[model samples]
Target: MYRYDNYDQTLVDERVTQFRDQMTRYLDGRLGEEEFRPLRLQNGLYIQKYAPMLRIAIPYGMLSSDQLRRLASIARRYDRGYGHFSTRQNLQLNWPAIETVPDILGELAEVQMHAIQTSGNCIRNTTSDQFAGIAADEVEDPRPWCELIRQWSTLHPEFAFLPRKFKIAVTGASSDRAAIQVHDIGLRLWRDDEGEVRVRVLAGGGLGRTPMIGDVVRDDLPWKHLLTYLEACVRVYNQFGRRDNKFKARIKILVKALGIEEFRRRVDAEWEHLKDGPQTLTPAAVEAAKTHFPEPERRPVSDEAIAAYEQQRQEDRALARFVTNNVTDHKVAGYKAVTLSLKRRELAPGDVTSDQMEAVADLAERFSFGEVRVTHEQNLVLSDVPVDQMVALWQALDELGMANPTVGTLNDIICCPGGDFCGLANAVSIPIAQALQERFEDLDFLYDLGPLDLNISGCMNACGHHHVGHIGILGVDKKGEEYYQVSLGGNSTDDASLGKILGPSFYREDVPDVIDKVLKVYVESRHADERFLDTYRRIGIKPFKERVYA
Candidate 1:
């Protein structure tokens, strides 16, 4: 994990002091709600249904055990006894007293974490794969670049007030676990034929009133010119992105209105002045930043983990199922990535109790070198667990009520804290997730179904990333009644595309049946071994639409 430098420390301290003064003025009636709105939003505070919610940034999803413990402590002392991990890989405290928010920010500052840039219409958190350092397929670790972007974007005067919120994601791995394609700016890190690092830049991707896969603007941009190209992107969006309508203010609308070629031309023209400038990335600075993220110390043990691996393959097939489903590939031999299921079917999908958080901290300390990651899918990951301890770890997690063996399955749902907690939500999203989980409980059947992502958002903000799920569900209000809409065939991989709306939205009672009908069509029509997404792509949405509506 990257620790804060002196500059980081100073910035956070100053920010807290500034916000403290701003908040005091608001309470003293000098600043009205309208006047104070943008200030509070920039600080990551939102006035929700019952109380104010504060979002704290977890850069690139990485956290040290000390940081996680501090978060747990903050939750216990200042707000409720738990925190909601968001799809942006950030944490939100739902019931923090508006007056004490500055105090919360101070505590976060002590741990080198803060709520800055977690919200508002500027550049938000720059996210990456949770398994960045440990992923087997990674060309290079993406965290250093993510950290660099974090520093550059923090309170950037030029981008502080964009037309709309901007999100950027990076992925070093061939697999697009970071959901890069759906971000405002997506950078895929790779090396070209001569072994020089380069980036594939995608622009104007987002989900809301309009959902889009970012168009590739720059292919194989050399690493040294990263900052220059990024600046061009920000300049372009700032100048021409929609400002008249909140719904169409995102960069996606701009890209769609101007064709991808024209958008690229505009950015390239802007890049002319930026190239070879002082802001361009240099070898020394890149290498210097890379030093902060040295690889974890390794000991070459006789791959003892393979024995446990074989035992798992032979013993309880359920445990094997759990292992393959929840664990990701690691860069080092004798080690594997483990995902602790915050999506425990017995509870709300992403809610973790204080005790559960503590247990996770303990596990991270014992097995994962004192580090944990929060994924965009709303799950927690111990990214480098030794493979030999797989069974024991599974048992421990199972005992702690954290193991559910449902990663990437139907039961592993992504749901917003809907009407129950969020003031903006029209209906409850958690109950809908729970109902679907119970309805799709058979693991063997689920395994047969293979690799389905079901995401739900209460309304149109798409915080739950409902736009890119393999099965996307959006809740809407119709005539004082709650209804759920389903969209199938959306993808978040390198070949990203938003799902088309299947039909009219369904009443809450009709949701599960509609899903069942869609799945049945898939089950009957799929070619052997084709996943839901593959099947959907093979046979377009028409058949499923007919079956679902018929």
Candidate 2:
């Protein structure tokens, strides 16, 4: 929704030109693979298993219909006719040719999107709640703060190459939908008793070989100092974060090594000089950032219209299930936010075809004010659909195969493009996800299970956020043989917690059966109205582990 100005346009246009030349040099042997590695990474190009993967930033997961359509066009013209929405809310074209990436970048620039700061040990995308201003429980819209951070972090000279990739997430809602607890820097926005905005800052949280819930470093920081305080946090990490080993280079590792007290002390000391300096936010600047995210025009619905919506949903069980699963309450009266399920059993999670993208763009324009929001859960959301048009929208989405009515169900899995596309993956992840989805295709079984998060990662990089899923499956390689390790009781919420390993790894063929056993244990042990997560947390992992390993 934030249109590029002259400065933004010039910056992107120039970067495209520079990358094009750099790519030409690499092809002509003027630059070797090692020499061109950083350059390519800085532009969000990764040499994957089969081809180059280009990750285009969708800042804070906001996309205009025009931008979405452009992405569809680019996917069709440059790569395969589909793209994967990553957990970071970025889109990855896994089959883009290395040489043609510049052309793809050029097309993205035309739509005010780019691959900048999307990869390579720098401050990556600053994500926020998908339902930001539209959420009923929001204290403040975090998008403005997210936008401010995006502008600050993008191409930042100070943090261009941190020890490892850095991720920051902001959330305005009481619910932790953004998973701030698992980010390098997590900001929770709220208002003080006097109505002044404040932030609860969390640091050193990540998942991989080591998983952690970010510690609360700054409990009550003023919103005006958000940028400057962040500067201090990253500056500390940039200076002291591990560099000797890539695996140990995340801020979480550093935080664990130094302890939270010392990390906070060092950050406070750094902020002493940077505070009230050029980076400190002002009222005018904050207001300017807010301008980019004006609320959608809202219309009051009549009581009769509300009644009609309720009547339709009540009369049709299918419509009611879809509504209960895919629709969320909006802050505005008679409006709702609808999630377009990308987790259909027919396709991999988060993989949207070019045609699907175009269709979503059209639907967003027709129902959601020409804009879409990408959720970190790998779903697309129309954040402002009127209640009066719910039935029509549901019918259209169901027809388009975007309405599986499994928003928070077991089949709505979070998965990575594992060995199929990722060179780092030790084993395939998509197939495991597919197997689970197919096994749990019964909506009655899924709804009975209730709000299960089944996440899979090909390896420990945890791109799938598997560490926080109610049930986590991580791919492991034992002497070149593919095996899957299972973890349970993980949760990414207000009370975030990392999962515990159940036992030793299982062969790929046994993964589905193992999961079925875990679910069976849960269903048998759970009390009335208890979720899988609550049941696991209550009864501990022993029951599921026993069932799974038995």
The CA lDDT of each predicted structure is 0.88, 0.93
Per-prediction TM-score: 0.97, 0.99
Model 1, runs deviating above 4 Å: none
Deviation in Å, model 2, residue 524 alpha carbon = 0.9
What is the TM-score (0 to 1) of candidate 1? 0.97
lDDT of 2: 0.93
Write one digit per residue (lDDT tens) for candidate 1, span 1-550: 7887898899999999999999999999999999999999999999999999999999899988889899999899888798889888999999999999999999999989999988899999999998898888889789999988888888999999999999999999888889888899999999988888999999988887778888899998999898889999989999999899989999989998998999999999999999999888888889888998888886554655577676766788878888879987777888889998887656677788777888899999888889999988888999877777778889999988777888889888988998878998978899899889878898888988999999999988887788888999999999889998898888888778788789899988888899899889999999999999999998999999999888
Residues 1-550, candidate 2: write the lDDT tens digits. Answer: 6778899999999999999999999999999989899899999999899888999999999999999999999999998899999999999999987889999999999989999989898999999899998999999999989999999998999888899999999999989899999999999998999999999999999888889999999999998899999999999999999899998999999999999999999999999999989988999999998998887777888889999999999999999999999999999889999999998766789999999999999999999999999999999999999999999999999888998899999998999999998999999999999888878799899889999999999999999888999999999999999999999989888989999999999999899999999999998998999999889989998888777767
- Model 2 residue runs over 4 Å out of place are none
Best-performing candidate as measured by lDDT: 2
lDDT of 1 at 360: 90
Winning candidate number (TM-score): 2
Clashes of each: 0, 0
